[model samples]
Each structure stands twice: as C-alpha cells, then as structure tokens.
Target: MRIAVAQMCSGISPIDNARVLQNYIGDAAAQKAEILFTPEMTGLVDRDRARAMAHIYPESEDPVLAAACAAAKHAQIWVALGSLAIQPIESGSEKSVNRSFLINPVGDIVARYDKIHLFDVDLDSGESWRESSAYQGGTQAVTARFGETVLGLSVCYDLRFPALYAGLTNAGAEILAIPAAFTVPTGKAHWEILLRARAIEAGVFVVAAAQCGAHEDGRKTYGHSLIVDPWGQVLLDMDTEIGVAVCDINLQEVAKTRRRIPAIANRRTFALPKDFG
Candidate 1:
C-alpha cells in the first residue's frame, strides 16, 4: 500500500490550516496514495487559550474537520487526520479535546480517538507546557479496521507509553499511527529512537506524521515525520520539511517480521516488586 504523510506547520487560524490540509489531500491523491497521515493539532495551534477557545468547536461543528472529510471524499482516499483541537463533548467543560479522526474514502468518519496522554513538561531550555490544563486526556486506546489491515491509534505523548502499543498489537493492529507535534529539544533526542523501538518490539509498521518549523503561535516544532517498518527500518523520513512524503509498504512484511521475532507470542507476565525505595 502507498501511504503519504503531511508535515506542516499549523498556525493559529483554523481556516488557514484547513486550506493546507486540502492541498495535501489533493497532492496525496494525485500520487495515488491510499491514505494520508497528518500531524497533531492540524486544525489550530495556539498558545493563547483565550484566543483559541473561539475557534474550537464540537466535532459535528468543526469546519476544519468538515473540510478534510469533504476533500478526502472528493479525492477518493482515506485520511488518518492526525489530531484536531476541538471543544470537549462534556457540556460544562471548559477544556477542549485533542482528537484524531479516521475518514473513509466516502468522507465519513469511521473512528475517532481522543489523545490519551496529555503532554506536561518543563524543559531545561525554559520551555514549559501544561497540556492537561487546556485539554482533557482520553481514557481509551483506539484501533480501527482499514481494508485488510487494522490500525492502532495514538498521538504525540502517547508514543512514550509502550504498553499501549503492545495492547494495540495484541488486539490485531498491524500498523500504528503516532501523530505528533514535538518540541525541538526532545524531538531531536528521543523521537527516532522511540519510534524504532516501538516498531521493533511490536513487530508492526509505525507511521508518525509530524509538525515542523516555527509556528504563528511563537513556538517551534521538531519535524521529522517517519515511517518505520516492522523490522525497525526507516522507510521515509521527512526531516524538517513542509511537504508530503510517500512510501509504498507491504502488509505481508508484518507477518514475516512477527514470525521471525516471535517476541509477541513469547511475552509472559511477572509479579512486580513490593518496594520502591
């Protein structure tokens, strides 16, 4: 299967971001890609909560999401729309939800996965973030069937948690989608290593579409969108580029790699230690 990843620097305006996505969708389709994977916060990226709140809408009402669906339908391609910033479904909630949508060729949403891990960090470079303050985390891990393959869903911070990937693979997911908007400090150090580890251990294909370059919100993102095969091979890496990277992958490799490793089948449970001291 031929898949495309869109590496873009999202701005604070949802409307502008929508236009970028539409172009990428058309570009991916023109290349005969089956699906297009995009980065997290594809709709809006704003540091000012007060300003962003006005743009965030419920899933049914979000214009960016609507545009993406329509574009996908028009192009006759599937879209793994990395993540969107949208209003939380809970009526009285003030925070929004970081949500991922899987759209079929007909432009219908087949699955939705809210980001389970909210990024909270204080970097040595004096960069601090409290993602939970602006968005509530999702409790469920998500996977969806796409033709002959099954896809495991996750977002930026979720990539750090390996057990989630384990469970997804155990549930019969052959490919893992880990869309991200990582910081420059961490992305350079741990991004590729972690992705390679995940693919190697899970024996699954890992696709990570990422946000790259400086944004209108005054923050910079590390852009190295990657596609790793089950054997931990880096198929394509769009290093700090604002464009689409396409690669053809074979689903049969998933089975071949798993059979050779047999680690997933060999996994066993053990008791934890009683003391932390």
Candidate 2:
C-alpha cells in the first residue's frame, strides 16, 4: 500500500487549515497515494483559549473535518486525519476532546479514536501546558481496519505509553499512526528515539505526520515527520518542511520483523512486587 504524510504548520484559522488540507489531499492523490496522514491539530493551533473556543465544534460541525471529508471524496483516497479538536459527546471535565478519525475512500468516517493521554507538563524551557484544562482525555483505545490491514490509532502524547502499542499489536494492528504537534524541546530530544523504539518493539510500521515551524499562535513545533519500518529502519523523514511525502507501506516487513523477534507473542504477564516501598 502507498501512503502520504503531510507535515504542516497549522495556523489559528480553521478555514485556512481546511484549505491547506485540501491542497495536501490533492498533492498526495497526485502522487498516487492511497491514504494520507496529517499532523495533530490539523485545523487550529491557538494559545489564546478564549479565541480558540469560538472555533471548537463537534465533529459533525467542524469545518476542517467537513472539508477533509469532501477533499478525500474528490480525491478518491482514504484519509487518516491525524487528530482534530472537537467537542466531546459527554464530558464535564473539559469542553472539547482530542480526536482522530479514519475516513474511507468514499469519505465516510469509519472509525474514531480520542486521545487518552493528555499532555500536561512544565518544561525547563519555561513552557508549560495544562492540556486537560482545555480538553478532556479519552478512556478507550481504538483501532481501525484499512484495506485488509489493521491500524492502531493514537495522538501526540500517547507515544510515550508503550503499553498502548502492545495492546494495539495484540489486537492485530499491523500499523500505528502517531500524529503529533510536538513542542521543540521534547521533539528534538525524544521524537525519533521513541518512534523507532515503538516500531522495533511492536514490529509494526510507525507513521508520524508532524506539525513543524513557528505558528501564528506565538509557538514553535518540532517538525520531523517520520516513517519507520518494523525493524526500526527509517524510510521517510520530512525534516522541518511544510510539505507532503508519499511512500510505500510494506506489510511483509511487519510479518518478517515479528517472525524474527516475536516480542509481542513472547510477552509474559507477571504480578507486580508488593510492598516494595
């Protein structure tokens, strides 16, 4: 299978983001890609909470979601829209949810996954974020079926949790999508390392479309959209560029890697030590 990853510097305008996504869809289709993956917060990236609140809408009403659907339909390609900020169905903890959607070739939503792990950190760079204050975390993990292959869905911060990948792989996921809008400091230090590790351990292909460059919201993102094979081989890396990359997805590699390592099957569940502290 052939796929495309779009590395973007998403602005604060949903409409503008929609237009950018449309162009990426066209570009990926032109390159004969079957599916296109985009970065997290593909629609809006604003630090001003009050300003961003006005654009937050349900999945049905989100302009970016609607536009992406239309673009996918016109292009006749599937789209693994990395993630979108949408209003949750029922949540009192926060007003919105970080969600990922899988749109089929016909532009119908086939699966949805909300980001279970929220990013709440205070960096030494003096950057702080209380993501939960703006969006609520999801409780369930999700995977999708695409062209006879299984796909695991996850978001930016979820990459840090390896157990999630283990569960996904055990559930028959051959590929994992970890779309992100990572901060510069975290991105430089751990982005590639973590992605490669996940691919190596799970023996699954890891595709990460990332947001890069400075944004209109007075923040910068580390942008190195990466695609790694099951054996931890780097196939494609879009570095610090706002563009799209099309590559082939070799499922055979996944099988070969798993057969070689068999880590997933060899995992043993042991009870934790009691009263260690």
Candidate 3:
C-alpha cells in the first residue's frame, strides 16, 4: 500500500489547519496514495490553555474532522487523522480529549482512539509540559482493519509504553501508527530509537508522522517523520521538514519477519515476584 506521511506546523485556528490539511490530502490523492497519515493535534496546536479551550469542540462539530472526512470521500482514499483536541461530552468541563480517528474511503469514522498517555515531564532543555492538566486520558486500546492490513492506533506519549505495543501486536496488528507532536529535546534523544525498538520487538510495521518546526505560539516541535518495516529497517525518514513523504509498503514483510524471529510465539509467561526481603 502507498501511504503519505504529512509533517505540519499547526497553530491556534482549526479552520486554517484544516485548509492546510486539505492541500496535503489533495497532494496525496494526486500521488495515488491509498492513505494519508497526519500528526497529532492536526486540528489545533496552541500553547495558551485558555485560548485552546475556548475553541474546543466535540467530534460532531469539529470543522477539521469534517473537512478531513469530506476530502477522504472525495479522493477515494483512506485517512488517519492523527489527533484532535476535542471537548468532553459533559458541558462546562475544563479538560478535553486528545482523540485520533480513522476515516474510510466512504467518509465514515471507522475507529476512534483517545490518547491514553498524557505527557507530563520536565526536560533538561528547560521545557516542561503537563498535558494531563488540559486533557483526559483514555482507558482503552484500539485496533482496526484497513483494507487487508490491521492497524494499531496510538498517540505521542503512548510511544514510550512497551506493554501497549505488545498488546496491540498480540491483538493482530500488522501496522502500528504513532502520531506525535514531540518536544525538541526528547525527539532528538529518544524518538528514532523508541520507534525502531517498538517495530523490532513487536514485529510490526511502524509509521509515525510528526509535527515539525515552530508554531505561532512560542513552542517548537521536532520533526523527523519516519516509516519502519517489521524487520527494523527504516524505509523513509523526513529530516525536520514541513511536507509530504510518500512510500510504498508490502505487508508480506511482516509475516516474513515474524516467522524468522518468532519472538511473539516464543514469549514465556512468568509469575510476578510476591515476596521481597
């Protein structure tokens, strides 16, 4: 399947971001891509908590989601809308949900996965974030089928959790998607290693589209969108650019890699330690 990974520097306006994404969607369709993958917070990426909250809307009313689905149906291509910052169902709530969606060719939402892990950390670069302060975490892990491939869905912070990827791999996921808007320090130090490790350990293809460059808010994001195969080989990597990177992938490599290593089947169950001195 041919997939397009889009790296964008989104700002406060959902309308403007949707317009930018429509251009990418049109480009992907022109390139004959079967699917397009966008980065996290594709709808909006403002650091100002109040302004972000002010513009927050539910999935039913989000203009970005509507535009994406409309474009997908028109292009006759599938789209992985990396994520959107959407308001909770309850009115007057302070926190919103960081949600990702899978839109089929018919412009229908086939699957939705809220980000389960919130990024709350202090970095050596003097960068700190408390994502949980503004967003609620999800309780479920989601996997869906697209055409002949089984897709595992995850967001930025979820990439650090190995157990989550293991669960998805065991649940019949052949392709794993991690859409992120990662900080510069962490992205430089741990991004590629973590992604390649996940693919190597799980024996599944890994596709990660990321936010690049600086946003209207003073915040900056590291952009190195990557696509790795089941054999732990990097198929394509965009080095900090705001553009579309397209590549063709074959699912047969997944089965071949799993059969050669067979680590998933060879896993040994062990009892947890109960007593400690």
Candidate 4:
C-alpha cells in the first residue's frame, strides 16, 4: 500500500493548522495514498502550558478533530491524526491528555491512543519541560487495522521506551507509527537512531511524521520526518519543511525480515546477574 507521512510546522491556531493539514491531505490523496499520517501536536503548538491547557476540549468539541475526520472521509484514506491536546474528564483540574486518533476512510474514529510517555526533563540548554505538569499520561498502547496491516500507535516521547514497541510487535503490529514534535537537540541526536533501532528490533515497518522549524512559542523542532522499512532502510525523508513523503510498503516484508532475524521470537526473560560486591 502507498503511505504518506506529512511533516508540518504548526502554530497556536487550530484553524490555521487544520488548513495546512487539509492541503497536505489533498496532496497525498491525489498521489493515491491509501493511508496518511501527520505529526504530533497536529492541532496547535503553544509554549505557554497554561494557555494550552485552557484551550483543551473534549474530542467532540475540538474543531480540528471534526475537520480531520471529515477530511479523511472525503479523501477516502485512513489517517492517523497524530496527537492533539484533549481536556480531561476529571473536574476542577487543568490537566489534559496528548491523544492520537485513528480515523477510518469513512471518517469514523476507530481507535485512540493517548501518549504514554510524558516528556519531563531539564535540558542542558536551560530549557526545562515538565509535560506531566499539564498533560495526563496514557496507560494503554493501541493498534488498529488498515487493510491487511495492523498499525501501532505511539507519540513523541513514547519513542524513547523500547518496551512499548516490543509490546506492539508482540500484539501483531506490522507497522509502527511515531508522530513527534521533538526538540532540536534530541531530534538531531537520537531521532533517526531510535527509529531505525525500533524498526530493526521489531522487524516491522516504521513511519514517523514530525514537526519542524520554529513555532510562535519561540521553540525550535527538528523536522526529519522519515519512513523506514523492516530492514532498517530509509525509504523517504523530509528535512525541515511542510511536506509529504510518499512510499510504497509491502506487508510481506515484515514477515520476511522477521523470518531472517527472528529476534522477536528469540526474546528471553532472565534475572540480572548478582552484584560482584
């Protein structure tokens, strides 16, 4: 099947972001893509944690979510609406969840996966992020079927946790989707490496759509959106632009790679060695 990964530069306005996404979706559809994917923070990117929290709403009330569903139905292609900030159900709290929606071609939400890993770190560049301060962490890993392929869902920080990918692979996922808005420092250093490693380890196809360039919040992102095959080969990559990378993926490759390596089946559970002291 032909798949397209969209790299975007999102700002603070959901309307504007949705328009950009609409155009890209149209382009991908014109190219006969069966499935399309977008990056994290697909609706909006606000550096002000408080403002972002205030803007959150239930999925039904979110304009971007509604628009994306309509677009998916119009395009007749399955779409992964990377991640959006969603208001929590709890009352009297300012917490939200970073959630991804899997929309079928009929514009129905088939499955949802909230970002499991929150990025809470103090960077060496004097930039500290406490993602948990504003966003509630998700507890489940999810996968959905698109044609004959089972696609696993994951978001930005979740890429750092190998166990998540392993779980997805074990759950019969043939393709893994990682949509991210990674900081420049981390993206440059570990983005490709981690993605390739995950693909190689799981012996599954990996599609990563990402955000790039600077946002209105004065934060920069590394935009190297990539699509890697089961053998850890990059099929297409977009470097710092609002564009789409198109590639043809054959599901048979997944089985072939796994048969050649068989690492997933060879996994062993063992206790750590005793300490010397």
lDDT of each: 0.93, 0.93, 0.92, 0.90
Write candidate 3's Cα lDDT for 41-60 as tens digits: 99899999988887789888
lDDT score for residue 75 of model 2: 96
TM-score of each: 0.97, 0.97, 0.96, 0.95
What is the per-residue lDDT of model 1 for residues 1-277, given as tens digits with 9 covering 90 to 100? Answer: 9999999999999999999999999999999999999999999988998899999999989999999999999999999999998887764787888999999999999999999888888978797889999889888889998778899999999999999999899899999999999989889999999999999997899999999999999989999999999999999999988988799999999999989998789888899889978
- Residue ranges of candidate 3 with Cα displaced over 4 Å: 90-93, 123-127
Candidate 3: pairs in clash: none
Tens digit per residue, CA lDDT, model 4, 133-237? 888898999999987789999998899899999999999999999999988988989999999999999899999999999898888999999999999999888
Model 3 root mean square deviation, Cα atoms: 1.5
User: Lowest lDDT 10-mer window, candidate 2?
Assistant: 87-96
Worst 10 residues of 3 by lDDT: 86-95
Candidates 2 and 4 compared: the better one by lDDT is: 2
**Whole-model alpha-carbon lDDT for candidate 3:** 0.92
Counted clashes in each candidate structure: 0, 0, 0, 0
State the displacement of the C-alpha of residue 177, model 4, in Å, after optimal TM-score superposition: 0.4
